[model samples]
Target chain A: MGKTIAEKILQSHLLDDGAVVEPGNIVRAWVDVALLNDVNGPIAFRHFANMGGGPVARPDKVVLVCDHFAPAPNAPGARLIGDMRRFAQEKGIEHFFDVGKGGIEHTLAPEQGLIVAGDLVAGGDSHTGTAGAFGAFGTGMSWAGMAAIMMLDETWFKVPESMRFELRGKKAPFVTGKDVILRVLGEIGVDGALYRSMEFGGPGVAELNIDERMAICNMMVEAGAKTGMVEPDAETEAYAKAHAKRAYTLVRADADAQYASRHDIDLAAMRPMVAKPYSPENVVAVDAAKGVHVDQVYMGNCANGTLTDLRQIASVLAGRKVARGTRAIIVPATQQVYVQAMKEGLIEQFIAAGAAVTTPTCGACFGGHNGALDDGEVAVATVNRNFKGRAGHAGAQVYLANSYVAAAAAVAGEIVDPAVL
Target chain B: MIFEGNIHVVGDHCDTDVMIPGRYLSLVEPCEIAKHIFEEVDPGFVKRVQPGDILVAGKNFGSGSGREHAPFGLKGLGLSCIVAASFSRTFYRMAIDLGLPILTCEAAARAAKVGQRARIDTASGEIRIDRQVFRTQPMPPFIQEIIEQGGLTAWVKAEVARRRASA
Candidate 1:
């Protein structure tokens, strides 16, 4: 049987002497990138110091981004930044980005050339899977797991069995990878695909750009899938050739690659979907569900702040303005994306449209700054999560949607269909 | 590695925000982190928690961002074990590597109720609750070894020291 793309990457990284690794078998594989941010960098630094590990094999291979709660308003936040700066200077990790230079952990890694197709990246943050958009086999780890990998250049993996998502037909203009992933969550339930790997393919996947692919892969963990992968095709080729540090090969499953399960979806039939307040698993179509009032509309994060995602938002908000009661916040995922959005005048349109453009930080998605909702306020966000209290006050609700729907909802100050706009 | 504790929580995809919010992330004091651990997902989480409690969760437990504090907070607060149907990719690896006992017993997570007392035997991968023994999915031998040695740092240090002493 032809192995899936995930298997191909795992195989390339697997050690020959490791215990027999089968589907469900866990083995520590080599990690190509180990990323940490300011919030957690200090802890990892202390842990690494205690370990007394030799100099990191490759300082440049490690990315230290200070996005979480940086530009500290408190003593704790300021101290974290200071701790990270001293550690970065001592270790000489070349990719360190301080407050102004860094944003979210997931976004900064990719933009800085730390993530590439087929690389195995491990981050100290859970959303590290966001890099899977670039075709890298990425996952998050604890500080200790990261420290170990930093020293040993290896970590454990459970070779997840494969599930195939074979999408068919072209999607509606407003329907996006976010909707598709929500649909996957609805079908698979929360743990239906637990500890499994999902491979997206078929005719429909061809239509998705790298951003959409990233969005789909970004939420694979939500479905309890260990990771999500797309067969590197023409889109992958184009992205890898242009953006990646190295040249690329479009890896795909052989005709007979084994799959544990399969999901066939028709994209054109999909409508604007929402992961209702508190959970991405509680998903429903926007029009089919009751509209809820929102205090904020946040568009950015590793999940949906890419160029493609931004373009979708612009299309919806082009000639419109965000409602007065709602604060529309747009965070470009990376410095490069921020630059591109500026050159394309998307930033001006977003600002004139009454949206607040913040630095390319993880920002509001993590409920850190700028757009955190007060108690009882609701937020419609383009980020991956909608878990309860995710955007600050537990009473404050956060609803997840695609960038188009997010933009539309920002304009309406409530959940609404992007198609209407 | 063996963990005996009271069952705690039935959360779904207990994200990092719940385990440790981004705001308090700047704080390095494990005690401060322990105070807010799971504060968001379950309001009374820290107050209600006991030292030897096990967290049983459904689906994608520890989903969203890879904050190591999620596990570190619990460990510092005297968490004994975490048994779930499934855990987020990074959380699971980090938990075991940090010497925190994490077992996966899909059926156990489904069968066990919050506050139930359970005992886990890491070597045998057996979990006993109310005298009913359930088997957890076994960790790889090397992973088991790491846990046995009190997580990655100790394991690595011991191995290197042993090699040097013999040499």
Candidate 2:
């Protein structure tokens, strides 16, 4: 009879004329954030202008960030960013982050305190679900959806049913939030949580920090989940209060709340996991991937390039050089992460270890540039997807693993269990 | 809207990337992007999809990146509708916003075959394919309004006009 966190948020934001919405019901609900990046922002902005919709519904809530292909790789990318800047200025949109100020929108929103608990947020990137770690109902919207929200300040939802995940035990050593999510994807397959709210709860969730939880929720998109949520607790409060832009409210699913399915996971028995080439759903134990030679190992992306991930990799690669003939790339998620990692000497340690520490960019992870595989090359990456041609040439192979696994692969020049190190 | 066309069938998880690869994300013109729609799956797909043609697929069609271009391109190519058992949430919204009507009929999705002549009556919620007839739920009134107004953009324009007049 009770509501999930997603239901509560949608219920609160329902339009005045909107009927009460239950799971599977459809209604228009106000969203707190309308976020987009350079890649997709121009299209939505163009659509908005063409609609003759004057001014944004809420300029402050419209966050336009230039991360993907920012610092413009070529004329087209630059033109798009230029168009976005003009739109932001002409429309008086406040949170417009240009090059250097913002990195990935997923990481930037939380860092700037723009997103908080119990909020409904939408971004134009599939990985926008990353913000759900803060207990916000974060999701990615298509260009048309973005345009609608910009013009009307509200969007519609089907009130997705909830799927509850209960982590029962302390996780295994070297296991990560990425590994946990990979395990879930492997067990359930890609469409396991389609159109469902994946709500994380239970004793073992406390073991993960906000960033780690983000790493897990970010990949919920890979499994076709509409959103991933964690009930905001003390840790959530600390993270929110540290950089929160507005008032915060912790939301939880009631004990008697209905769920489509509930999964109880034993974290301690989990093993280091990797998603083999072609699909994030194609997962295997780290042992199964051992000694598989790799040409590159990339440890960055909205999924795993957080400050914690950088620290985890630094601790693994300290005083050791990258393996011969292997390229190691470390990308911080944001300027703040870059600065913090530099201050913590993690960047120095990585550079000293022969790893290339690039600026915060989603480029390499999405196979844009800065780092990409050529034909016949293989890589072990910390990015979420390893779909064909996702990171490089269609003939190139990409394997997805956690930061520790990626770092170990860099050192060993091959995929392997970090526990063996 | 009632439409009759040949069905171009695809299987589950027909991702947006395959529909319109990211390599063409920079192309703002929907028709330009439409030229490459389904370039990977069937290189001649764009050449064959006539105006008002229909696409039918299994579960989880449009399952990749949130480019929004794929649906827009499909619409620009004059695709009348997409009927599938299910659609990725983002893609479903995109299809709706692009004025591309989508009906979810499991019976049609499973029974419809490629190259079959199909007719959809959105108002009647009937899907007729060759000799098979499948029933689907009509779009809710709110969704119908958006479709009638020609996608989200035109709907917003009309709403803005009405609001200004009232004010």
**C-alpha RMSD for every candidate:** 2.5, 1.7
Per-residue lDDT tens digits for candidate 2, residues B70-158, read: 88888888888889988888888778887889988888999988889999988778999999999989988888888888888888888
Which stretches in model 1 have alpha-carbon errors above 4 Å? A17-21, B5-12, B40-48, B56-60, B106-117, B162-167
- Alpha carbon deviation, residue A167, candidate 1 (Å): 2.0
- lDDT (tens digit, per residue) of candidate 1 on A261-316: 98899998998888887777888889865468778888887768889988998998
Chain A only: TM-score per candidate: 0.95, 0.98
Interface RMSD of 1: 2.1
Residue A212 of model 2, lDDT score: 90
In model 2, the Cα lDDT at residue A332 comes to: 90
lDDT string, candidate 2, A2-55, tens digits: 888888878878886557768878887888888889888999888887888677
User: Best-fitting candidate, measured by lDDT?
Assistant: 2
> Which residue segments of model 2 deviate by more than 4 Å?
none
